[model samples]
Target chain A: MKSHTYTLRVEFGDCDPAQIVWFPNFFRWVDAASRHFFVQCGLPDWKTTERERGILGTPLADTQAKFLRPASYGDVLQIESHVSEWRRRSFVMKHQIRRADVVLVEITEVRVFARRKGDGSDPHAIESVAVPEDWRAMCE
Target chain B: MKSHTYTLRVEFGDCDPAQIVWFPNFFRWVDAASRHFFVQCGLPDWKTTERERGILGTPLADTQAKFLRPASYGDVLQIESHVSEWRRRSFVMKHQIRRADVVLVEITEVRVFARRKGDGSDPHAIESVAVPEDWRAMCE
Candidate 1:
């Protein structure tokens, strides 16, 4: 599968009081990278997808990450992301965050295409849908 | 081990375009819950620990999380956290985020007590330290 790279610069606010990139901020960047991968693959934005197909967005089902090294503000980082596997209702995305040649973190996420549940029980509820063939083809 | 619960109200800014809580924000809340667990165990703040014992903070080595449900702004959530296991130089924390009686997310984190590496190779480098016996005692 083709991979997409999303580059970002660490900001002071991204770091915690310990002067290291707060772990949660890494997730934020990875989330952006996930979306960037879809965009680079010629997929429409979530809003457009929702309007066309009722797919609101891809929401994470599960995620695992290993933090190998700490990153601080002023560092330029690149996140290389790709869809590693496509399941019936979910897919796995693999992401490697690197500062130059050093890999700082690696993450694997299982995400599903979700749409709002219109059953009127809970307005905020969402349900996952099967992987769309067209979307998977574009990503591949 | 004793467990601690941290409560917070989800804000509008924490949600993404889907009007659900952005996944990364869950990590942020879990991180806070981790620290709050330590504080509830009578451990000093990171600054004090660093000043007195050269322990900067517990930095995550690895983490895994499962997102069970989506939450939106105006929801009041509680994260219950506790150390599930302690290794020689690392420990595992388990967190469950809930809205009322509904569990929204579950996370497991392997973290280490880290200190700045003063050997002068990389200023931002950090090294893990063995779990402090006194601190572990306090937590237990």
Candidate 2:
């Protein structure tokens, strides 16, 4: 199982009036970590893929997250992410947000390889594509 | 059931390289919508509640969100939020994110009214408080 770790510093703007890191900020960091994992696994930029293969990017189909502990601004957090499962057209990515040895949040996301609909159809329409074997090999 | 709506304009920084509003930004808006619901229902700010009753803001325990459509910068989105269920120590909030009549995302969150542990214990420790009758009445 290959894993990538993304580190971030919680800034003042990331916290709410309660002085704790706002929950949505955690999602932002996790989303960034998801992309970083792919980059580290040798995947090209999404722009390149969209231009070459019409593969826009991985778009999340479903996501569930649990907050186990609260973090405050100025804290340093690390997100450890890895692909936990791979299906025909979708995959699950798991992320554990931790401060030192204490786990703060956990997230699991199901995402698909998306491509814009062609054939003179709706410009905003997108559909899922099968998992590319070469991308999977590179990730693994 | 009483519901409150909050509207916001998507800003440039809220979008990603794809020129679409990033997924996490929707969570941010929904979080703000959750707070706005309480405010619209005539509840005081978290600061007031914390000072008077030792009740911090509601903290999310779990959340599930589905992205039905993508949004972009400059788009105006509205979120309709309301309390769908109330339990002893937790409650569920449902948020519908829309651009006019088109729903862009749906989110359901389980959150708890939290208070700091006062047992001369760890400062960061927090525990859920039973749903306050007065507060529930205000929301309803």
Q: Per-model C-alpha lDDT, please?
A: 0.93, 0.89
Worst 10 residues of 2 chain B by lDDT: B117-126
In model 1, the runs with Cα more than 4 Å from the true position are A119-123, B119-123
- Report the lDDT tens digits of candidate 2 across residue range B1-140: 99999999988898776667878888888888998999998989898998998887999999999988887777899999999999999999999999999998999999999888866244357888999999999888
How many clashing pairs per prediction, in order? 0, 0
Model 1 agreement with the true structure over B85-121: per-residue lDDT tens digits: 9899999999999999999999999999998887535
Give the per-residue Cα lDDT of candidate 1 at B30.
92
Q: What 10-residue stretch in candidate 1 chain A is worst by lDDT? A: A116-125
**Chain A, model 2: TM:** 0.96
lDDT of 2 by residue, A1-140 (tens): 89999999988888876677888888889889999999999999899998898887898888999999988877899999999999999999999999999999999999999887765244347788999999999888
